[model samples]
Target: MQKSKSFAKYADAEAFRAAMEDDVRRGRYHDPHQESRLFADVAVEWLHGKLDLKASTRSRYERELRVYVNPKWGAVPLRAITRNGIQQWVEGLTTGDYPAELPDGRSPRPLRPRSIRNIVKVVMGGVLEYAHDQRWIVENPIEKVTTPRSWIRTTTRCI
Candidate 1:
């Protein structure tokens, strides 16, 4: 198959072509067309493909996808989900910086670090990892994302 891309600078175009050739040689090339799939679609597919998850676990995964992941990433194409974007999303969760209206029609609120981590792990991790496995993306952006510390230790114990 042949693909064409336009770059404003010839050097940039050459660099991109060189990278593509190297990726192809190393068997790391991913078809650009697959990256257009929506995140919600991929997440649903990934969740459904897990046959061994406990009922409760599956329920939680679904909830996380609906409440957290989907609201932010549902309509976005897989190629647009970058590590920086994931990092910003995580920061927003911690800071209550989301839009006023979420999918469930409730106002956004800051989530605890532990809760944020679980959402990232169970929802983001599962979906992005699946995308990588499907060759929809060249790499899992979540691998580079870091969540905030879950909690701070208290210096003194309660009496």
Candidate 2:
């Protein structure tokens, strides 16, 4: 049976059963044993292998991964990262209730929702895509997550 990346680590048995149901609905499943690598290891390999990114973009992604994503999810097995966990993590970013303190030499500050979205897109999105391609997980969990919506404000000028 194949497993999707949305299966959460430490999830209850019922969650696994639900995931199996989801797999049947999707017409595919995941092998839990296939996801043995730590997320950090896969992310680093992907970062080094991507020759298409501009130096600045690559640097920014690396920094974001190191300062934010890694500290929280790096040690997790790729298959064990669930959509709910990701959503909660994203919410934590906006609520200033992050799962872990930033790694050494990084400062915590109020991050705008847009910034948080971008970090998730660039770091988590990229890593999960790579993981999916490697068949480490059946689907990219990032695709199932919801980032904060962008809000726009307009001021009316009196005539």
Candidate 3:
């Protein structure tokens, strides 16, 4: 058998090595260097590869990407994001500085839960879904982040 490549992480060298052993044994070993594509790059690939979307829908998704997703996560690597970090970022979008401006010239207000949910689903969710399909990350972190809950109606009789 060929010698396994050696690499060093700042910490967790043994754990990382163990993980690599499993990957090698399974023929799933990926070069750590090539796996470092930034989220921004993945997002671009996703946008361009989405041949099924209507022009208007694609435009809307692109706008959402620029307005909501890119500013915060564009420079981050696909694997660097964590569930807790994503949750905190979503929470931040729920209040204070990131408020949406009213079209009627009123004071800016925090994004509505539905809007936040849509942003998460459409922009962040789409990019991560693409990344997951491409195997850039072992699993999509988007699945682990919680978006603000929106109201759902259940069928019931009213008096």
Task: List the global CA lDDT of all models.
Answer: 0.87, 0.82, 0.75
Per-residue CA lDDT of candidate 3, range 89-158, in tens?
7887787355332346555346788878877877788888887666567767778788888888789989
Clashes of each: 0, 6, 0
lDDT for each residue of candidate 1 in 25-141, tens digit (9 for 90 to 100)? 988998889999999999989998999999998998888888778888999999899999999999999899864335556778898988889999657898999999888899999
What residue pairs are clashing in model 1? none
Q: What's the lDDT for residue 49 in model 2? A: 85
**Winner by TM-score between candidate 2 and candidate 1:** 1
lDDT of 1 at 50: 95
**Which residue pairs does candidate 2 place in steric collision?**
1-30, 2-29, 2-30, 2-31, 3-29, 3-30
- Top candidate when judged by lDDT against the true structure: 1
Worst 10 residues of 3 by lDDT: 96-105
**Stronger candidate by lDDT (1 vs 3):** 1
Q: Residue 138 error for model 3, in Å?
A: 1.4
Give the TM-score of each candidate. 0.77, 0.72, 0.72
TM-score of 3: 0.72
Off by over 4 Å in 3: 1-4, 7-29, 98-109, 152-159
Q: Per-residue lDDT of 60-154 in model 2, one digit per residue for the tens?
A: 88888887898889999887898889988888888777755475746566579788988887688988999887767888888978888889889
